[model samples]
Target: MMQRTISTTKHWIVIVLMSVLGCGLLIQGGYMQAKAHFAQFLIERAFEQTLVDNQPHKPWSWADTHPVAKMRVLQQQTDGFQPLGSDLYVLAGASGRNLAFGPGLMLGGAGLGEQGNTIIAGHRDSHFMRLQYVKLGDIIELYSTEGERVLYQITATEVVHETDMKVLAPTAEKHLTLITCYPFDQLSGNAEYRYIVEAKPIDAQPLYS
Candidate 1:
């Protein structure tokens, strides 16, 4: 009888441990989802303010990050053109926390809408997830803080080692480079490769005018 009681106790202990682990996983997932939604909300507000004031705008009062640019993927057709998805706000720096919120414009690169290479980095599972669907010849529009909208056409997409620096090289012509982790579906802790998208300016005129 005592052996049976001990066996029953062991079973209950196992059940309790599993229950705690399962609850932990659920809470973690929910927190992450909430964080992503909140970040996007902040970004949207910043983007709107930037457009209204024609100046850089911070998403929140205490945030060190500010919206530097707005990006949209354009879908062109014989009859008309439309944006593929909602606008994504580009943040000032690509720190891990910043990327969790939005795409980050690399410092020391060409200023937005300028005549040099501009590099931006975003997380694969979040802000840059749609980049996988971007194809050659697809048009990308960048709205800068100065209220200038520039059009660019995708020229190339490639995968390179994470340490490759050539992809960020400076150029005399206007260019936009997007960097994200490769194998978009992978959930690994260490991302060894990067997916890069290069676009060249096709129009110099401001989009709004």
Candidate 2:
């Protein structure tokens, strides 16, 4: 009789442990999904505000980052490569915390529409996933907070070690640089490589409204 009671207690303890683990996983998954959705909403609001006011706008009261520009890739074929889509919100500052919310502009780099290089970075799983499809000669439209829209033609794409700092170097002419982690479909662990896209301004006039 004592053996039976001990066995039953052990079984119940195992069941309780499993239940707790399941609940923890469920909560984590739910929170991640919710965060992704909320980040998109925040980006959209910030983009709209920048367009309407022609000034930097924060998505939320507590946000340390603000919308600095809006970017879209042209759908036309460029060197036999066509991008999937052309809509992205550019946020100020590219810290890990800022990137969790959306694509961020590197703070020390030149501002959008400036004469030097402007570097932007986004998460591989979310904001920059579409970058994998971008190809040479594809046009990228960047709208700045000053109500100026500049067009950039993609000139190059490369994979480099994460420690390569040359990718972020300032240019003598206007340029746009995008950075994201490599191996977009990785299931686990941080990637050691980075995927980079480089573009040069093509038009002097603001083409996008």
Candidate 3:
């Protein structure tokens, strides 16, 4: 009958709509899960790479997974804190992730505590994502491969635009800057602002190479 045909058509349309919505949700969940996993992987790697070996070497590559550097005498919450060497800190996003969002290479500056400001950058999802949890006076540590250890303390935190160059400038006294995505809880994946952690160098060792 004509009535039966119309009912069947409506049922099919409803089924198709449900299917489409389900598919969309699945895709979105997958993307968010992937971002979270990548973030976790980054922190763990930093811990193993910098904590276990504090001093990082020149021309250090993310591909080079071995102990290219080492750190000594960590400060702050040493257990959870993964101190980046001055080598990788200056290089600036060497791991295909713009911890700094610029074209410059990662960790290009010298690795030490005597510099003006050892600026370090990492990706929000792939590196330094835990920076969101950091508080004032949090300790930062670094160790070198040639038997050197350095320590820093978080003095303050700030949020700035991506193009703000003052965040990376050198200061009159030795300092360390940790930068990552601002509003770390954003779900839209748009990095609008940057979180800056200002710290001062407490320990320094002369270059032994």
Estimate the TM-score of every prediction.
Answer: 0.81, 0.77, 0.55
Model 3 misplaced stretches (Cα beyond 4 Å): 1-110, 187-189, 203-209
For model 2, how does the per-residue alpha-carbon lDDT over 1-209 read when each residue is reduced to its tens digit? 99999999999999999999999977885686568558767877877877787776778888888878777876454244344554677888999988887789998899988889999998887778888887787777877776677888889999999889999898998999999999887724579999999999885433332
Return whichever of 2 and 3 wins on TM-score: 2
- CA shift at 13, candidate 1, in angstroms? 9.1
* TM-score ranking of the models: 1, 2, 3
How many residue pairs collide in each prediction? 0, 2, 20
Give lDDT per model, in order.
Answer: 0.84, 0.81, 0.55
- Error in Å for residue 106 of model 2: 0.2
**lDDT of candidate 1 over 110-168, digit per residue (tens):** 88888889999988876787888888877889888767888888899999998999999
Off by over 4 Å in 1: 1-30, 76-80, 204-209
Q: Cα deviation in Å at residue 163, candidate 3?
A: 2.5
lDDT of 3 by residue, 166-202 (tens): 8777677777777777777664567878888788875
Q: RMSD for each model, in Å, please?
A: 3.8, 4.8, 8.1
Candidate with the larger lDDT of 1 and 2: 1
Model 1 lDDT, full chain set: 0.84
